[model samples]
Target chain A: MAEMRREWIVNAVLAMALLIVPLVALWINEPFYVTLATRVAILALAGVGLNLALGLGGMVSFGHAAYFGLGGYVAGIMAHHAFTGLPMWIGVTGSNQMLWIWLWAALLSGFLALIIGALSLRTSGIFFIMITLAFAQMIFYFTLSWPAYGGEDGLPIFVRNQFPGLNTMRPWDMFILSYGVLMLALVFFAMLRAARFGAALMAIRQNPDRAAAVGISPFGVKLAAFVLSGMITGLAGAMMADLTRFVSPAMIAWQMSGELIVIIILGGVGRLFGPVAGAAILVAFEVIFGGITEHWQFFLGLILLGVVLFARGGLIGLLAGRARHG
Target chain B: MSVALFAEQLLNGVQFGLMLFLMAAGLTLVFGVMGLINLAHGSLYMIGAFVCAAAAAAFGSFWLGLIAGLAAAAAAGALIELTVIRRLYDRDHLDQVLATFALILILSEGVRMIFGPFPLYLSVPDLLRGTVDLGITRYSLYRLALIGIGIAVAIGLWLLIAKTRLGIQIRAGESDREMIAALGVNIRWLYTVVFALGAALAGMAGALVGAIQSVQVGMGEPVLILAFVVIVIGGIGSIKGAMVGALLVGVIDTMGRFLLPRIFAAFLDPAQAMGVGAALASMLIYLLMALVLILRPRGLFPAHG
Candidate 1:
């Protein structure tokens, strides 16, 4: 009975935090914050993607930004080609449509993840970390040197990719769309965690040899988790590019990858809606600190240091206290 | 590309690889000895470059600047190892990664505060500024000198590890920590000294490269990535492997940048060809690494029994 109340209160708190505040802000016409909230929401969705792998599966990937950038590029490129009358490729119809672009982004990142994960998963521990990082760096350098899109300067989407009926140019509309995606991602995350595959992933994360002995192919499970994780992150990236209307090589940079990891650490590793809280904290810290000081990165660094050293189990973990039973 | 250009690129690649080796050697050693995955290794590289630049400007001598940079890097390494890193020695990789990432932030922002946003240039000595004419090709004499210095350092490290008593302790520490501590070997001092030595090597690499490139705020970042690649390729924790890995990566990267575009130009328009080809070629080494890892998860040369 007490457990029921605890769960109810937690859900209520999360719903109020995620939905109520944003809706109130919208009604109040404080749309400036709505835009920022959307930024946090989309990035949080991306964090959810990573949390599935890193948090639940104990896979520390340093290359998820490659998928993120690939997703962004997919959005930007399809839009650019549609605008400029350039075909995506020969013997196939191109799409500048947001939904279709997202579909492609998801598929492309999933495929890339299959390759990266396949190669990287051969080595465990630090080797896995380094290999992922190296592959991401390769992609980053390629994006920087390749001038077809924009090279180091990044490409801007002059108009948001068309989303059927929505007027995405309006701030509130974009925020609503981002909010919708965040809900979908959260639901997907919850459903995924409840699945048998999720159980296998958790089992493998706990002990790979044990999982393998129990007839779960640790390799396949990990690879599948990694690919799904990439696809989710890719979806977020596709939306983010359109949100900011810009895509650059920096999207795939190692620092961006590290930032995602940082965000996950800030929230809580495997908790539901943890990314939402983490993104909120990170973006809020950025907004407030950035407004006050030009060199807010110094302060952000200090805060990050404090959290890493002192916070222990992140916001959710601190608040919830190990969820009573793992 | 001309033969001279090919040779020159090869030389440039070697130079890059050696620098990577210097950075990776320390990182791999730390990993091997302590099981610590440090992200602040890059910050140490930045610290090295910053100190080199500052000291060079103040002292008006490149050699003195190099020495000062080495001193600063070593001191920073020793201090951090003694205070925070020592505590983390027994912790897991995740904690170490987080702490080191934090250190990178602190060091980067601290340096930026001290030395504004503007890049500080490290001028090569007038004595080593000229080009060496290799009959078919001419390259910077300073770069060739760098290669020579790198080789000497590699040999010096080899001797220090193979013949010296310190090497035995480092090896023992890698194998077993508690046993060594029980041996009354002053294990703490050994760890500190090894860390400081690693920092000095990284600093020397930074100081040397400072002459060729503009020493900027975030200059150490790219080199940090390359060093990671080197260590990954050259089997983590092996000094000899690091030397070999550095040269291979350096040459391949340089050659790819110089030649791949021309090769693609043969097939496509010059503009698109150069853009696509150069990008793909830059990624080739990483692709190679991926393939290697798939085949041999422990890298080309694993360093354990």
Candidate 2:
């Protein structure tokens, strides 16, 4: 119980820091710092998405980038058509409303996850990892070859998508919107972790046979978790595309998927604020060490190796102690 | 397509498949024996290419470079096994994946630091350069040599695994690790040897391929993923499966790219057909993999049973 209280305090501090730092940057007129904070929030949201499956549900999906990239494409394609005043298909037109794009991004990625998860969940262990990877590669290659929307070059959104009463063109406004979504996602993640479904999902993750014996249908629970996980990550992708003002196949690359996993592991799997901490640390490392030398990734690799070998519990684990449950 | 064109494409497919087999064989061997999925296996491939390119340039001998590439990869593999991978054998797949991924960042950056950002060039040996006249059509001599080398390696691997005393120990180790150790077969040494052996094959493939393609940093990543796809389709830990899967992926991928656009053009406009067919062609191997998994979840050849 003491540990629980400590964790909550840590989470609260992390959340406040994420918001206040960006606000401070905006007040100081440092748009670059604001952009960096926005990146942390958005990436943390994506990490939160993966945390649902990886930490809580024990599905180490290596292909979350597929959903992330798919969401970006959704945002990019819609904004592209809206800007050009062109029809998307036959009767359908493009939408520049952030809300509509978010809905479609979530829905489409959720649907994709349904199919991929259904197929992938059939296998477990290393097979599951590779299959997820292969599926993501399938999407990556498709996007690379299909030249309609820039192909390998990628698509760009000339104007930021509109939000109600907010000029998203301003970096501060965009940071506010991103930060708000991240907070909502963190709340949703916390709620889901405490829900009946989360318990069943975590139960299945611990022991599938026992989970099945308890009449909780392992397949159904995992599939649902996977879909929800993909949807959250997808939402992050949409926001990321908007933040960058461009969408490319690089978004779907395997490295992006790897980075997402790295974030979850670095933050502390299953911990609520793990993603937020991981993203902040990762970005900080990139900026700090990157400024030092061209070969900063070498040091980054060494640190990650140390983390995997010695610090399995990640940053949160180091600070808050082992997870309360399991 | 004309018969000659078809024949040429088929040979290209075979050649590509053969190279893939070289990569998959080592990958499967490592997985079969160690139960470790080394993402850094691809880094070994890159090392082979870079070292071979550098050696060839220094010595002005492709043959010397090939040998040097193989030795360097094998040595690197053994070193990594002793320091990093040995610890990971008892760990779960997730840890193995991350550790090896970290190794990739380290190794790739290390190589870049030495080799700089630009790609290195490796020309084909004089003996393998130029075209050869087959009965049906002319083909690149270097490609034909690659096909020959691939077949030879496959046969040699089969013989080694089936006939040699070391092969018996390897088979035993795969089926029962503790048993082999208990039998005083020196399991630790065996693992290092196997890792080096696998790394050598990957390196050889990289060196050979480097002669044809530009040798650059991150070059092995695409091949690595494809090799993963190959091993998955072939069934993990099965060399025969790796060979078959490699061939299937290589042929289907090459032929799909070659034929899909023309097939689409039969009905759709050429421009649209080209775009659509190219997209589908790129996805064709993965679709094949998905279908295979649906039909046989454990892959075509489950190693255990």
Candidate 3:
């Protein structure tokens, strides 16, 4: 119980730090820092999505990037059609509205998750990992070869899509939007974690047979979690596309999937704010180390190796002590 | 396509499958023996190609480079097993995946730091450079040699597994790690040897394929994913499964690419067909994998069952 309070405190600090850093940067006319904070928020949203499945549900999906990339394509393709005044298949014209884009991204990725999870959840252990990866690679290659929306070159959003009231052209506004979504997702994750469904999901993760014996269908719970997870990540992907104003197959690459897992592991698996902390640290490392040398990834790799080998609890775990449940 | 072209494509598929077998063999063996999924296996492949390319350039002998590449990969494999992977044996798959993924980032960036970002080219040995004539078609001698080598390795592996004492221990280890240890087998040494052997195979494939494809920083990744597909289809931890799966994936993939565009051209406009064909062709093996999963959830051969 004390550990829980400590974790709450840590989460509060992380949230404040995320918001305050960007606000400070905005005050000082440092738009670069605001952009970095936005990257952290957007990536944290994606990581939070994966955490629902990976941390709580014990499905180590190595293909969440499929949804992420799908979401990006959703945004990119929609924006492209809107700009060109062309109808998307069946005369469905595109909308420049971010809300519409987010809804479609969530729905499309959720549907995709249903299909992929249905197939992938049929296998467990290493087979699940590989199958998920294979599915993502299929999508990645498809995007690379399909030239309608710019193919390997990727499609650029010449202008950021519109929100109802804010001017997203300003870096601070974009950060606010991303951070707002991230906070909402975090709250949703917290509520879910405390819910009956979350308990069943975690129970299934701990032991499938036991979970099934208790009248909880492991597959159903896992599949639901996977779809929800994919939807959240997909929403992040759409937001990421808006933040970067571009969408490419690289977003769907296996490395991105790996990185998402990395973020979760770095922050502390299953912890509510793990993704937030993980994203902050990862982006900070990228900016700081990336400035120091061309081979910043080498150092990043070394740090990750250290974390996996010795400090398995990750940054959140390190600060708040081992997880209460664990 | 003409009969000659078709025949040539068949051989190409077979050759590609054989190369995939080399990678899948190591991957499956490691999984079967240690129950560890090493994502850095591809990095070892990259290491093999880089070392072979560098050595061949320095020594002016492809044979010397091949030997060096094999040794480097094996040694690196042994080193990592001793240092890092040794710890992950008891951990969950997620840790193993993350640790190995980190290894890739380190190795890739380390290689980039040392070799720079540009790709290095490896030339086929003089003895295997030219084309060889068969009745149906002429093919590159090097490619034909690769097929021959793949066959030889498969046979050699079969004999080692079936007839040799180490093979007995390996088969035992796969079924029961604790039992093998209790039987007085130096399980630790056996694991190192197995890992090194697998690494050598991956390295050899890298060195061999490096001749055809440029030796680059991220070359092993695509092949690694393909190997994952092969092993998943074959049945994890089964060598025979790896062979069958590798051949199936390689042939299907190559044929898909070769035939799909032309097939689509018949129905769709030429340009649209080319684009659609290329996209579908790229996804062909993954589709095959999904089909295999649907039919045999545990793969063609379930190692445990």
Candidate with top lDDT is 3
How well is each residue in B160-222 modelled by candidate 2, as lDDT tens digits? 999999899999988999988998999999999999999999999999999999999898888
Q: Each prediction's interface RMSD?
A: 1.4, 0.7, 0.6
Model 3 CA lDDT for position B163: 99
lDDT of each: 0.84, 0.93, 0.95
Question: TM-scores across all candidates?
Answer: 0.96, 0.99, 0.99
List, for all models, the DockQ compared with the true complex: 0.71, 0.83, 0.90
Instruction: Tell how far residue B288 is off in model 2, in angstroms.
Output: 0.3
Order the candidates by DockQ, highest first — what do you get? 3, 2, 1
Off by over 4 Å in 3: none
Cα distance off (Å), candidate 1, residue A76: 0.4
Q: Which ten residues in a row are the worst by lDDT in model 1 chain B?
A: B90-99
For residues B56-95, could you state the per-residue lDDT of candidate 1 as single tens digits?
Answer: 8998988888889999989999998886788788766666
Identify the superior model by DockQ, candidate 1 or candidate 2: 2
lDDT of 3 by residue, A251-318 (tens): 99999999999999999999999999999899999999999998999999999999999998899999
Local error of candidate 3 at residue A55 (angstroms) = 0.6
State which candidate, 1 or 2, has the greater TM-score.
2
lDDT of 2 at B273: 99
Residues B1-36, candidate 3: write the lDDT tens digits.
799999989999999999999999999999999999
